[model samples]
Target chain A: MTGRDRSGGTRAWGLTVAVLAALAAMWPLLPDYNQITLARVMVFAIFAIGYNILFGYTGLLSLGHALFFAAGLYAAGLGARDGGLTAVPAFLAGILAGAGLAAGVGALALRTAGVAFMIVTLMFAQAGYLALLYFNEWTRGDEGFNLPAASRTVLGLELAGADMRYGTALALFALATLIATWLARSPLGRVMVAVRENEARAAMLGYDTGRVKLAAVTISGAFSGAAGAAYGLIDGYAGATFASVQYSILPLLWVLVGGAGTVLGPLVGAVFMFYLIDLTSGLTDAYMLVAGAVLVLVTLFAPRGIMGEVRRRVARWLP
Target chain B: MDFGPHLMLAAIEGAVAAAVLALTALGLSLVFGVMRVVNVAHGEFFMLGAVLAWAVAHLVPGPAWAGYLAALVLAPLLVGLLAAAADWVVLKRVQYDPERTIVATIGLLYILQQATLMAYGPEARPVAAPFDARIALPWPEWGPEGLVLTWPWGLGTTAWKLVVIAAAALLVALVFVLVQRSRAGLVMRATQFDRETAQAFGIPVARVFALTFALGAALAAIGGVLVVPIQQAHYLMGGDPLLLSFIVVIIGGLGSLRGTVVAAILIGMSDGIVSVFFSPTLAKILATLLVAFVLIFRPQGLYGTRAA
Candidate 1:
């Protein structure tokens, strides 16, 4: 509704650098327990950022991104276990699997728009989840599979410890955030915004809206997939629950609360929700009740999300 | 393997499934058709109905029939009221923005589910059927001289199951009549057709929306009440009904009542046969795949008019 940019590119870059520096500084100071939780936050942050490419910037509200996330995690986890490959190779396989799955699903789902697109993606994700459940031989269904401790080692770093896992998660989160920020500023990102703002107008202007959307979905899927891989590596477990609709909705809650389109929204939302869950879980097992209540309050009161609202109010003060 | 008896059994199972699915899907379809907001918590309402039925039947001091009857009438009404309250407290505050309402309903879903879990516990509980006289199904077999009817002992269904089918059909018909014939229906249709214009013409648009939402929930609740006797009630029972209802709604065409019924019957029947013959998981997979196909090839659905 108002101007978001108030200064030259340097301000935004500086802000990002400052935020990353602050996060990096907290690594050593955070206790072991907090470190593990923070690692999870980082993985989910990666998910939210990738999800933002389609939902936040591109105006696609998918309830099925968990499909790709799980795909990526399983691809990497299983790849490492089955192929006896190292972290980098297994992670690469996960990216390919995630991207490939996204491309395939995107090609079909892109044909529909609005609510139909959401349902279509959900259907695909549901089917994928069911497949995971039924094909117990591969996925172990709901029983879940534990990663062999050795596979946790990525790039010669043994990630069996909290510090190493957290470090890996931090590096991945930084890379994902930087990539997402760069993409958001790219010409392709502008086109994605155009498609989001008005699809018909973008099509009239000779942009293949479908192709643009497909590209966005694929990119988003790849990021989610990478996040999934990292998540498994960080947690040392993989399960069909990774692909559930609940996981799909989790990032949505994060992005919506943090701020949909903003680069920092996912990070903020992920940290806020991660801690919120931790705090509520400490209080009672009925943490979901609290989470659900927060979702309602935020959606009703802060539909633009915390950062989005803050930006709107303090436009001149922000990048 | 002789498949005739199995086919017959599957058809009977499908009929029962279709009866309940029609009610649930119809509710979802009505909410979408009228309010233009997808209540992601629609399944939760169905769960509430079943759960409440269990509560009412258990807590109310009466004969089993009395409790069953009370649940049959009261559970849906209570859930309807709850839905109406939700519409007022939450949806109205948000101005019923489609996307935002979805998130709100998701929140509502968690709240309802968790609340149920806290109150009722996670274990599945079965309600005693009002009357469950087992009736043996007769199949025509060719004798040496002529065709004769042979009774199969294993192929027997409870009279209550038939009652469920009958009751659901009657309710569906009653809903159709009320929507088509009543003055309240007129208001709902008016609001659905053009909310702004309807408001200009002196329609209580908000009330109509609220009422429509309640009615939708009530229908699903009624469906849930009917099925609780057959399927055990649990906090997690809502997920499948929600997904199945969505599949029915999508295939039948969003907001198309007639299409919803047709699609429900098709899906219900297929699900019944497949689940019995193959596996329930396979049935669900097929349904999900069918939704994908419908979305890709016929996004407008079978009966949905193309958006102008």
Candidate 2:
């Protein structure tokens, strides 16, 4: 790599190091509550990254992302609740459930483009949410469900404490980041970018644009499911709220505000949004108002997002 | 249940729902037709109109009829001005990119919803009808044991529903006349068809767009005001309508007023009839599924022309 590439790669590596360092430093100082918050933020970042694959890479806006997220949460929650599976198997089940759900929805929704795609995805997501609500006996509806506290074991190693959960979350976050980075450099990743740039042209070049979109959505859903399972395990609860329209949009905002094109963007955006939510909740009861204002301001002034802005400024300084 | 009364009620409910949905969807369709941006915040404009109508009625403290009249005339005009200003400030800047505009409008939706919550405190505000009077239609009743017939009447019943329906119809008629016969409407149609060509022909394309946005806002506001009598105005009232309007616009076809009207009516009737047999939540799910199926098969919608 050249100096520029080296610096870019270094910056990416530095982010992981910084996050790990911060986690290590804060481990002893953070209470259970803050640990839970950090875990939630990391999980949401995972979810947002999944979203960025489809929205950022493929240029398809699927409003029903919560469907996949919820599928994972419910799969894990139900599987673990019934005592049929442990943490690892339940987590895998969740990922499978999310992927299946995305594949099914993507089959029909990927047929159209633009607003139609948005509406179809939204329709399926809402349908899934309603189905959960209607089957209240199964999902417990809006009341939500709690997971029994069990010692999480990873390959014969016992992880029972809050610290262990934190470590587990960090490991999952790292794995997700690594996978996302690898995918971005893969041939499939290049095809996704090409599809995003021009679907017609991509199709003209003998690419199955529909299959590419579906594959991206399916993979994205799998990661989102992983995130949801982590969320359920860490929080010890899962609800239909995880599948709501609000949850669906929050990630979109995170991706947009942090910058969608970069792997680091969703991570930074998630952390920024989570902290912003915490800060704004302290300021006013209307956290949504502040969020909305931020969305508007970002879209209007910084369409390239925070990371994009930083890159531009850094480039100007270097030149 | 008597078939006559059941059918009558369903018809009335369907027609009223259709009228309101059509008026709202028309504005949305028109905006999308001319400027390919789907205004996600259109529903908020509708909610604002409803809230304004309630505010005017409550603050003025007049005869119920007078309050209704005031809301009908003033609420839309005021909200239309607000819509025009929003178009000027935010939408005009991002007109070239539909996707960016979608994001921007979604942002605007958040701001408007938050502003509403800040103002109204997240509570549902009920708007009282001007008159307590009800019109009852006597029905033939059939039972297992005996035959009984009675006129049905209640608070927020059929008469008020009809009144709202009439107002919506009037607005639709007005829009039709304006678009079909008026000079401004002709200019708008010309600009929508070919922006560059219209500009080349010395037509004020920018002005047409601004005016179209304002008009769409005004129509949405009217729908909002009409809906307040039946449903309470709240901060989140805009969300359901926004989703429903999307379905209507998609089914009707983008940029076709006639298509929007038909789609809205179809959706409204379907919702009403489905809700009667099934739960409201289920009805919503069904309606959404129906739209999804239709879009998958006929991607351009029932009336939409294929994009070039």
Candidate 3:
């Protein structure tokens, strides 16, 4: 919005580049298990970042992003397995499916605001989950399916290798991060925030608030869709569990914990959440007990989440 | 085997489901109406009731009827108290802010689920019905001269299922009496109407909120207790009921008790009939989409006047 914001953006760009460099450098040193976990973290990070566009910026709390994510997963998984598309084409198909679904969902769902929107989206996702189960011959139901080992090769880089897998995930994460930060600073992004702050006011200014919301959701789907596509391809699995309400709640949780409306919050939140679960599960089978307790405490004391808090107290230009 | 008898069986089974759903959805309506907060963990409370009933039944070394009856009586009460405590410890601290409450309750859901997993294990465990007797149902058939009654194959229901229907109706009746006639009901209604004004009148709105939350949970628990004999108690059992009750609550209209029950019956009956007509998953998908369309086209719900 100002010159200061631009310079803040530059500094942020430098910081991101340095961070990426460090991550790239550390890739070879990390163990095989850690590399896989890190890839998962980046995938969730992409999911959260994409989710933030609508939830954090547009102020639309969708409990159905899992539908888009799973749409992407299935689109890619099936395309490569059955449609005989290459890895890139399969991934593109996933993103297109995700965006198309989000646009369709937003068309009807956006008519209702607030809680109605949430419930409508939830029901749609519920339908999607059931659809996945109903078409079990194709989806393999709850058990999910794996792509052929050859299908795992993306752009001639075999994701079967640990380094290639982690590098590809990191590359996707960097792309998502760049796009997210750009969107946050873009004119449409400001309009989205305007809508979030006050939809009536935004509409009064002659902005098509509905379109902006739909756009936000569609773009969000594209982002998370890429994550889902990458995740299925890299992880070699696509399953119904990823389409469940639990998956929907996970992105929301990550966004809230990382700081809503912040470009980098999703990454921080996803990493923190990943490590938190990883560490807790090592000690006990009831890792979710600890996770639940942390959620309560975070909501109680740090409602702004990690990055939201960071933005407030330390980094005024975090976004 | 025939369409008429199959439809009849679906209707009866649907009634059984409607009975349970009404109990669950009514509870949801109360909490949403009075407290104005969505408790995402409501189904977990239901799961707890069934799990607790199983535990209680296991502890009681007696006839199956004796243990089952004890669980039916005790589980809901215990769950209500637990829900009230949760409200005090978690919800009250958050001031019942709608979004925050959702997150907190989700957190509460995880805690409850993980605790159950730790203590109860991941297995689906079932408790026996207090009494079970199969009785054949007669279908009317047109003869050459007159009408005759014929027993249809697979048209029998257990005595316990009828008991569930009766028990649910009685509990629902008790809730109506409590809400419409009792002093606490008046307080709850007052709070629901206007929280600040009720507080000004020294209504102890906070306590009413707690009571409303507890009662909602208890109703869901009763549903769970009744259902446990029919289905096993699993940690993951809460998810479907949660989705179905949400559909009922929305289709019924938020905070509209009559509408909630009506929608519950409508949904439950359709669920049964549709499952019989098609696949169960297809039935669920249709019901879910129905709620979404209902909310989109008529946010007021079937019986609701206001777009709540």
Candidate 4:
């Protein structure tokens, strides 16, 4: 490989290492509240990353991603509530259920392109939300469902408190990030990009565009499910709000604000947006307003996102 | 079960719903037809119009009817100017990238919604109907064969909503006439069909785009103002109609004005009928699912060309 290629590889590796080290160092210093908040951010980042696979990679925007997330949350919450399963098993059940639900929904939704995809996905998500509301006996509707205070354990290591939960979240975040990065470099990933660029051309080149999109959406849903599971476990509560339109749209904003189509974009976007929410809420009751303004500013000025801008600047400096 | 009352109520609700939905979808359809950009903030413009009307009607010191009239005339005009500014300031920059435009509009939506929340608070605002008069239809007597037809008292909100609907229909007809017959409409059609060709012909393309967006915003604002009495005005009220308009635009086919009106009626009637039997949430689900089925089977919508 050329020196430039070697340098690029090194830089990517370096960036990942730096971020990991920083997170590890900050873990011990974070307060209990902040730890929980960080966990929430990581979970949302995972969700956003999953969304990126469809929107950023496949060039298809699914407005109903919250459906899968809610599926996971409900699955885990119900499993735990039933008293038939432990936290780990319950979480696993949630993940599987979420993936299954997403796959089923994606099969139909991925049939169309552009606004059709958006509208169909939204319809499915809204349907899911309505179903939950209709079956209020199970989902508890607006009041939300709470878990029976499950302890956290990792490979028989009993760390059954907030710290342990935070660590577990960090570990999951790492795994999700690694998987996303690897996926982006995989052959399937390349095909997704090709499909995103031009579906007709990709089809001419013997690629099954629909299958590729379905796969991307399914995988994305699984990751989002994992995030939802984490949210349930950490918060000890799950509600229809998790499945609402707001959840779906907020993550899209995160992806856009953080610079979608990149490994770090969702993470950066989630952290920035969550903290911005905290800051705005503190300043005034109209936090949504500030959040909305920030979104507008970001979209207007930095369509590539903050990371995209950083990457561009870094590239210029290196050259 | 006697179907007469149900059918009558459904028809009345459907007509009102269709009138408003058509107005809202008209702008969205026009924008998409002309600019090839999906303005996600279209609903926000509607909300802004509602809020503007509320403010003007309540805050202005005048007779109730006069204030209402002023609001009806001024709110949409003000919103149209705001929309035109957005077009020039934000939308114009992203014209080359439609996806970017989508993101930008979403951001605009967020900002507008939040701003409304901050300014108006979360409370729903009531706008007094201009007239309290009720038109009563006589109740039908029950038959011996266990069949019954009953008509409860039917009341219309001010004649204003019907007037607004009529006026809007007339306005849309005028637009159609202007677009299909006039020189400006020819330019708009020409530009929509081929921006390069229109530019080549020296037809100021950008001005047409700005005008179309303004027109769409104005239409949405007009709908918002008219809807105030039927539904209370509020900041977050735009979301439902926005979703409905999106479905309407999609079902009607993008860029087809005729399709928009047809789809709006279809959706409105479907919603009105379904809600009579099903829960509101279930009705929403069914409505959305219907749209999805259409989208999957016919992505170009019921009337439009293939998805672009």
Least accurate stretch of 10 residues (summed lDDT) in model 2 chain A? A310-319
- Scanning candidate 4 chain B in windows of ten residues, the lowest lDDT window is B136-145
Ranking by lDDT: 1, 3, 2, 4
What are the per-residue Cα lDDT tens digits for candidate 2 across A210-278?
899999989989988888887887677889988888778888899898887677778889889889889
Candidate order by TM-score, highest to lowest? 3, 1, 2, 4
Model 1 chain A — which ten-residue stretch has the worst lDDT? A1-10
Fraction of true contacts kept, per model?
0.66, 0.63, 0.82, 0.74
Give the lowest summed-lDDT range of ten residues in model 1 chain B.
Answer: B141-150
Candidate 3 scores an iRMS of 1.6
Clashes of each: 0, 0, 0, 0
Whose DockQ is greatest here? 3
Query: Per-residue lDDT tens digits of candidate 3, residues B1-308?
Result: 55675676677788898899999989988999889888888899889889999999999888988998888889989999999999998899999988788888888999999999999999999888876444422223322211223333333334566778889989888999999999888999899899999999999887888889999999999999999988899987887778888889888888888888899889898898888888989999998999999999999887776675
lDDT of 4 by residue, A124-158 (tens): 88888888898898889979977776533446654
TM-score of each: 0.94, 0.92, 0.95, 0.92
lDDT of each: 0.87, 0.81, 0.87, 0.80
lDDT of 2 by residue, B1-308 (tens): 76655655666778888899989988998888887778989999989988888888887766876887798889989988887788888888876477777777888898888888778777888887766545332222222222223233422376678777887888888888998899988898888888899999999887788788888988998899888888888878888788888889888877788888888989988788777667778988887887787788886787888530
Candidate 2: pairs in clash: none
Residue B165 lDDT (model 2): 80
